[model samples]
Target: MTYSRSQDSPDRRAEFPQTDLRGSIDGLLNAFYQGTSKEAARYDLTTHEFNLLSACLKRKEECTATELARVLPVDASRISRIVTILVDRGLLKRRRLPSDRRVVMLSLSEEGVELTTRILRRINRNSARLMEGIDEDEIHIFTSVVSRIVTNHDAIQNSE
Candidate 1:
């Protein structure tokens, strides 16, 4: 659905109009990402780097650059560059797989773990502060809606 406002007071108030799902969802998604990126900026982590670290932490096992490329939406070349940089900076380890000498695995270093944990904690605190006044029921509804959208998107991508 679309939310529109008249020329008179478009800045302050908007009229809710019947619109397609695509635009509404796109707008909301963009806004949410912008907000997240802003929050992540405080910890001095580029969005992509934070994402890579977060993915590694979630895996809890040796993850390959290829796997990270598959899990993350970025291009393989970008992942390759990021992985190389992380390895060079001692934030991630690179090793050959015992099963297949041709393959390489990656895991977070101790320093990487510490930094990622600190950044996550900071972000979580910021989110909690931001949500302090919101109603619990509304938060639940919002979460349910976002989760359904993510699930549907994942299913479609997996099928492809």
Candidate 2:
């Protein structure tokens, strides 16, 4: 699908021609979330908790709540609540940074790492199954297009 500016207001309005793209994207997202939710439930986690753990695993270093909030779609308060639950459950560690006593740093606990790894493995397997019939070239093109879409989305958001 292509992006176009609406003649109604070139500066304020954009349009994407009605196509299967929206439906297809929605279907893919729904399927992915359904699979993730099921896998997360196996570990007694909500999808939000699972997402927080996954983000922490990717950081590979202690990070602040602000950093996580930047990456996550949730608000700061929601992030705080999730962090509290994870910390209390022993899946995450929270410590005040020495250089900045007021700032709390977050990291995955050993248990969190293990659980994230297992969940990632399951998710990867599911992804492989989902892409079983697709060729590498097709996958590459799909990823490139998706990246462009994300860039466009960010541009629009920032512009506003």
Candidate 3:
């Protein structure tokens, strides 16, 4: 079930037969997310919850649920639910904009900030370990290919 580029033939078409390429990418993402889920659980957070927290940490600005939905893959309703859970857990602060009471802005609480920082350090260390053997050129090429794949996927989705 594992994939290796060494298994590919000289023909570029054979470099990634459709099903094999899809399977390889799926397998890689599933494995990566499994690890992430385990790590997030250690902090009493689901992968999605951790992602929301990380997004808040990165933005460092109070953002609306709609803004989060735009940046994240999750829909607005899901973001709202997660935000509610986070707010209840005291990991997030929710406030209405004075100018617009209808707009609820979200930011991390102090405790949330501390926990997120620790988790980020661990994630950064893990990522560094994951990239240990890979050179910068290989990383660049991989990133480029992934970007193209994502673009192609978006095009396909839009066509549908």
Candidate 4:
């Protein structure tokens, strides 16, 4: 007897048309996060840790844990975890303010500052590689479109 393959065998290709928009968004977000995490890991840091460092770098002065939680897009617990790890690594110094014992201010230690600067240079190099084929005008337009998408989402949420 001869055996034959079924004509209704499952398709091997991606069913993009059948996939939900939310699923696509989730996939892209996960891939982006994973890539960034790998990049951070190369420099002995996690994405969250790098984000905290970046937030501190952007701030005009020392920032408190609450302030960091507010400024960064992540939740408070995640901020706390990253802060704890940075402190353990001796890359971040946390001090309780004399005026307010409840508030813990965070600042980069000398090592943390050095590490952040080095990581930033590496990130810039990687970004340059990614933007190699893209022109300045196209980059600006892309950024504008992204900004509009964010604004549109914000408006939708506010209108609800």
Best by lDDT: 2
The TM-score of predicted model 4 comes to: 0.74
What's the C-alpha lDDT at position 14 in model 3?
67
> What is every candidate's alpha-carbon RMSD to the true fold?
4.7, 6.3, 3.4, 7.2
Off by over 4 Å in 1: 1-44, 158-160
82: Cα error in model 4, Å: 1.5
Model 4 clash count equals 0
Name the best candidate (by TM-score).
2
What are the Cα lDDT values of the candidates?
0.78, 0.89, 0.86, 0.77
Against the true structure, candidate 1 reaches a TM-score of: 0.75
Error of 3 at 150 (Å): 2.0
Q: Kindly list the per-residue Cα lDDT of model 1 for residues 31-93, writing each as its tens digit.
A: 656656775577666778778988998899988888999889899999999888787778889
What TM-score against the true fold does each predicted structure earn?
Answer: 0.75, 0.88, 0.82, 0.74
Ranking by lDDT: 2, 3, 1, 4
Model 4, 1-71: lDDT tens digits are 32223322346224433334345456646665666677789988878899899778778478988899887
**What does candidate 3's lDDT look like per residue over 40-141, in tens digits?**
899889999998999999999999889889888899899989999999999999999899899888999999998888888877777777678999999999
User: What TM-score does prediction 3 earn?
Assistant: 0.82
